[model samples]
Target: MGRQVLTWIGAQAAASGRRYVRLATARDDRPLRAYYERAGYRHVGDPPHAKWPTSLYERAIESG
Candidate 1:
């Protein structure tokens, strides 16, 4: 059910011509990062002056 919802959201993003889905997670959050990785997100970098050690990630919206 979770995967289905994510897939649907990805489809919507793609249909809207968005090239990437961006998100942020705490750098120390290994489990959360793993979850995003499992969903195909790649860690890009960290945001500037973040209050906590937050990491940025993005997933490409493959054009159909």
Candidate 2:
């Protein structure tokens, strides 16, 4: 269900001329990170300025 929602949101973003969708999650949340990975998001790395243990992920929008 979450994957579907993310896909839908990505679709909307892509339709609006966005090239990517980026997000962050706590480093300890393995399950949620895995979910995002399965949904086609790639782990980029943590932001240098973040105060917490956050993992960054980005997904490229496919051209239709």
Candidate 3:
């Protein structure tokens, strides 16, 4: 079941012509953010803010 779901997700991403898919979560969401990095995402930087900071991540897609 997991394999089937992953396969479908890959197909959709490929068909969408997306460059890369990144993962991020709020500071309060440390667990979720950790998951993203573990899934091959890199920490790029933080978002513009005054009171608090926002997390940002990036992943590059294959290019033809």
Q: What is candidate 1's CA lDDT for residue 21?
A: 80
Ranking by TM-score: 2, 1, 3
Global lDDT of each model? 0.90, 0.92, 0.64
Q: Which structure is stronger by TM-score: 1 or 3?
A: 1
Candidate RMSDs in Å, in order, are: 1.5, 1.2, 4.0
Highest TM-score: which candidate?
Answer: 2
How do the residues 1-64 of candidate 1 rate in per-residue lDDT, one tens digit apiece? 8678778878989989999988899999999899889999999998789999999998999886
TM-scores of all candidate predictions against the true structure? 0.82, 0.88, 0.57
Q: Which stretches of candidate 1 lie over 4 Å from their true place?
A: none
* Clashing residue pairs in candidate 3 (N, C-alpha, C atoms within 3 angstroms): none
Candidate 3, residue 1: CA error in Å? Answer: 9.8
* Candidate 3 structure quality by residue, lDDT tens digits, 1-64: 6446534554566679976765445756787677667655688877667256568776565555
- The stretch of ten residues in a row with the least summed lDDT in candidate 1 is 1-10
